[model samples]
Target: MSGSGIGHDQWKTRFGFMLAAMGSAVGLGNIWRFSYVAGESGGATFLLIYLFFVLIIGIPLLLTEFSIGKAGQMDAVGSFKRLAPNTKWHLTGLMGVIGGILILSFYSVVSGWTLFYLYQYVTGAYWTEPDGGFGAAFEAWTSNPVAPLFWQALFLGLTILIVMRGIKKGIEKANNLLMPALAILLIFMAVYGLTLDGASEGLAFLFTPDWSMLTEPSVYFMALGQAFFSLSIGICGMLTYSSYLKAKDRLPAATVGIGLMDTVFALIAGVMIFTAVFSYGVEPDSGPPLVFIILPSIFEGMPAGHIVGIVFFVLLTMAAFSSALSLLELPVAYVHRTLGLTRKAATLIMGSIIFVLGIAASLGFGVWSHIQINGNNILDMMDNITANVILPLGGLLMAIFVGWYLNRNQAINNSEIESPILQKVWYNIVRFLVPVVMIVILFISLFDI
Candidate 1:
């Protein structure tokens, strides 16, 4: 029952496992980046392509990650080592381990920004009418060296504390509350948003596809990236969580459920945000700025602006928190198992290191703005390097290893699904479609060719 010599904890219930996996999948990327990317990539067309990729690429890859962890019952790196001892396949897990740490470093920095904005909303700072508008307010907040670092450290500390508590008490329980509450809040926002003046236009913008945009290659590339990123794949977060699962636990159901729920959450959040954006008469293609700069203005102009602002930011933070927990867990699980450190000790050590890295990311926004790698700031560089380079590469290796390296019978047996036909479909996807699509996405992401 232990991947390493040390015993592991099982999720107390089936629902608990689902909640944890879903929580990991549904993160800030789903709500914030999904909306903006969908807008920039041609609205409904992007949504269609994204879902297609999720079905073909994301779900199959998700099952591959789950099977690896469940079958090996180890942390990401050890999972590979256990699955295929005396082989280089374990390098995929190593990449995932490093990618997890890298992603969380910048991720916590942005999560910290969410916390700051949540505080601003609670204090009526951003809700009240401002002379320079929400854009200026966001600039002022993000550009402040001390405040951003404080919030980043605070968020990292909170994430560390949760991981310190171990699986059942910490990760499972938090998701049980957070995911459902997030869903309710998002629905409330969407319902309210639909009632806004520009609801028709917003819905049209979201549901109506611009056919010509789909002809471009970049749309497919971006959709593929979004599908992978939105599911929290390629970073070993899913693999880490699934490692704690019991053998009897059915992975295919979990995989499909998580994939569907995560995509649904993003679509719901996208519509909610777009409704507000269209209502405010602003362009939806504002990229990342749409969340911080544009959304605040939308909230401020709405009825009960203060109340909506508070709820919105709170939802954002909750989403970020859930995702951050999984990211932190991957490296902590590795350190805990390999070094034989207590969960608390491993969490503290890894969390401290990540906090320090996060500090540099925070400073890159202001004090160290001059510091640039290949014309990108530290934060942007970390993001691009991980998302564009590391994640896809990890995913590519995973697809190849799971599809080709691992025995077909082993993967199907570990999946715990009874349907032979379904297993065949999953294997074909992992073997053929995923690797090819991932290569295209990776090349486009890195060289921009």
Candidate 2:
């Protein structure tokens, strides 16, 4: 494989790179997962804490990843090897690659569900409302071993096709198309939700913070985890994406833009979901089933709800697709560069293997439901392992490497922050605060304390 230089694929424009990076950050986490977690954690208070973490922790780590990628100018693993030659820092990159693969395995299963929901809407099948309620319908459909697997395969196939086309033509182009569409869809839905009868209640629930919850330790823990996960920093997806960027790219501006857009998308998604939930008299803290069961049921009862249902699912599928592309691209970049394989060959090989792994995740909701790891079903087991364990560990190691090992001046220069004050602030956070908080998160996730 070639080293970081003119040999690497470069982003065509700064805007394109921003969109692609934002696409990675604003996935199902923003909409599906963000909504439920926010609801469960105490809507307004949780959001406040989440934003705090994003500002202090998320942006610093994001800049760290960007700096690493730009300086190394190679795939995730190659970048580490290039930067810290003869050191084991590359193992962190390897861990990130593994985390990406594991995350996408179960992530694809959920994205497949989004596609299936989209198909149901487009075909007008959702209007019929089966014998059991939407809750029962979702349970039955997900539990059907064959059906979920088919959708999962289809979703993974789409991701593979995009990655195989290479960066400028495949990944960048797809994000350029999908990210704007997702934004428009989200804004439109949020506006529509405002017209509902329960808009007031939904708004209050999402924006009015309860100071009491601020003292809760679990709230802070969940917020920190969400900030890391939502920013897509820990898995080296940002590092891999930034590897394609030119030296002139402004890392700070891109970091802020991506982080702000991601947070706003989550808030808007909360508004859209909670408004519909309240308007339809459904519970706000409905957990994971909030999107699959609660929202669909709400859509069925609203006027012109079928059209809204189509739009909602279409938005969801786009968000999931954009994120999945980045996840798959992480491993694809590593394999293509390290193994000396063509992008097409690498994508196909990695994509096929991930698909096979996702089949087990899909079965977990059905036939494999009986199987549990630490009380989590198959899919949940994968999610917990990656999100809780692998991702936090990876992020922690990255902070340590950047803060303690990387050349301080070179790291600051790579960050592209002009203000000396801000530079010191960022360096210290990544060096000190970030590692401590990440350790706490890792410990909590491991022991479930």
Candidate 3:
């Protein structure tokens, strides 16, 4: 294949396509961020409002992305340029592609954390650990740069391998197995966690509103931001996945499937974490270290800590890989389409370059720990741009493009996506409610509200 462009393959089935899309959207963000934000908000109250924004803002925008991708059968670059006729819409694709680059750099670092745990598990490390070792271990891992970088490259390379296998054998095959397996593992973990003695306190903490926490105006805005971020909105992942969609698939239904799945997983993580922490009479809001610090302690004294530890980390690694592969792919596909590079060439070349870049992100953990412009490290910087800037803007643009630029009926029903009353609801949100909410979110985010 040399420098030649890669071949594009259609999804094997509509179901496979749905799994791939959902797999990307329903990864770490949903599992970790959503419930925490929900807890910070008025819990059930925020959940209701979030449901509104998700269906309206998340689903409609998602449909728009997919519709654009399938309509042009093009990557982000070609899709917009084709639609707007010399307008700047096409450049948004470049923005999305670059955002992927920025995200993957730091993203892999965290994924590396999962990998390190996996290694520890196989070695029976967690099984032999002291009660408080989990926190110290996590500290040792992050406080040093070397370990983060090594595992980050390992994670990124794994992601590239799956993508380079092409869509059918790679994305579709892997997600079909991985997503359901992930769900199953989480459920088992949740059940096991429920049995733990300390799990109830965490549950109470998670479900309790603490309405006093609602005083900050930023809380609501942050809730909306979390909902978007957790669902992988505004990243063009939705758009890119839709690019592979067949016309026969109902765009609305597919989006609903993906959105609901994303929401479900987040809530499940909440329950899983809640049961474990509360059972042990431990508080859950321990922050950042919640996953690394809390879960390992909970599992260590369990009957099969080594087995569960291995399973947990393996599942997390796979989840990270699924999302990262899709992230890397957005740009690789663009490179192939716009620059005419082959899939293998794109994967290997881009993969290698990103692999090296991953080192900088990995180093941010320890040796390069001193590097910071505004007290933000590489991962923090990348997350800020993608979540606060690039993503919201993309979502905002999609709402405008779908609601204003194109004929309403044609733009929406054009995909022939099913879902009756809900579609109308999404239409209304896209037209009025979501835009207003998102505009407020954009403004609030600008000032760090």
Candidate 4:
């Protein structure tokens, strides 16, 4: 294959495609956000609801994206334009392209934090901090305007270098190495963390249900949002990735496999995080800093502490890297295909724009601290806009377009599933359940309605 060509690539194999999709789905959100959301939403109850959303909503949307991409044989925006020509359905793809860009803006900021912490762990910087000092250290780091921007630029530079190499060489090869290493490291960390004295308490906190908490409407909305966002469904990168798939690949099986693996990774991360929470008596729902702040404090008290810290932070960076690559690729794919730019040129352009946006997010913690949209600073505002509004809006459009706009027989035929009964069930979920649930959550989240 020619290195810079736009429309001339296929994944090397089915395994490669699935692993790439899974890598995109499983990221920093799985560890930091999922664990906190699960804890705040009532643990086992939240898990059950999240799994329901994953199966009923996530899997079908995954298949929908794969089917559209494979049949259309184009990038996310081009796929819609190809599939339903002369219609507004392509706007769904546009939302995804823009959404991916918005997501990366702030995502890189957090990824920068992970990169900085990885540096600290590797250099034994954490060793010098006083006991129970990670929270202060993290605050100090974020509140420093120049340092976070430096890290964000460094992280975005790494992401751009990988993506500039073209799809098969850049995306597929990176995921092939990184995803397996991530899975193995997560399992090891989970098992080791469980050896702590308060493991039982952690287990109970995760598995034991507080049924009364289910009455809170916020938990339902939270679980549903996590279900959609955690799988990387609404962001449009999945469609771009699957656009590289060959027709021989089974969409149904691939979708389910990716969803299951992503969910399992999040669960395992919860094990690692919550065990440390209970052992160290750290607050479980301490929000976004649980992994960066609390986990480091927990590690400080463990034997072979620095080694464990290095492994954990490295795993976190890998997770962030995998997802950020996909985010960067979404716009790159669009620009390369739609605007006639070379893949490398598109990648560099999009990466640079996202890096510039990330500087604002980085400064939101320090220089721009006084500015707020509804009391959220720049980073949190970017996160809120993308996660709360754009994602669900994109997802809502995707469900409707796949469920209602596209021809049913074509969708079924394109999906390449073997079972007739399963096809009917998938169609119903996409058409009805997914749209209703997505709109409800989107309204509640965006408007507090």
lDDT of 3 by residue, 167-188 (tens): 8888899999998888889788
Worst ten in a row by lDDT for model 2: 1-10
What's the TM-score of each model vs. the native?
0.96, 0.96, 0.91, 0.95
Q: What is the lDDT of candidate 3?
A: 0.73
For model 4, what is the error of residue 225's alpha carbon versus the real structure, in angstroms, after optimal superposition? 1.6
Q: Is candidate 1 or candidate 3 better by lDDT?
A: 1
Local accuracy of candidate 1 as per-residue lDDT tens digits, 1-449: 44443757667877898888888888888877788788888798898888888998888888888888888888898889988999988888888888888888888988998998899888777877577787787777777988888989899999988889989999899889998998899888888877888888888888888899877777887787777778888878898888888766788887889999998888888888888888889998987668988888877778898898898889999999999999999999999988999999999999988888888887887888899976678987887678667766777788888788878887778767688898888888888988887777667655654
**lDDT by residue for model 2 over 71-165, one digit each (tens)?**
88988899999889999999989999998998899899999999999999999988667778888999999999798889999999999999889
User: Which 10-residue window of candidate 1 scores lowest in summed lDDT?
Assistant: 1-10
- Residue-level lDDT of model 4, residues 1-449, one tens digit each, is 12322465788989998888888999977987898778767788888778888888878888877777777778888888878989988888888888899889888999989998889988788955655488888888898978888888899999999988867898899999999999889888988988898988888888888888777667777777787778998767898888887766768788889999999998888877887889889778777677878888778889987889899888989998999989998899889877888888998899989988888888888878998877679877777677667776777788788788877897788777779999898888889998887777666655653
Ranking of models by lDDT: 2, 1, 4, 3
Position 86, candidate 1: lDDT: 98
Off by over 4 Å in 2: 1-7, 441-448
Candidate 2 local Cα displacement, residue 404, angstroms: 0.9
Clashes of 1: 0
Residue pairs clashing, model 2: none
Q: Between candidates 3 and 4, which one is better according to TM-score?
A: 4
For candidate 2, the per-residue lDDT at 54 reads 90
The C-alpha lDDT values of all candidates are 0.84, 0.87, 0.73, 0.83
Candidate 1: C-alpha RMSD to true structure equals: 1.7
> What residue pairs are clashing in model 4?
none
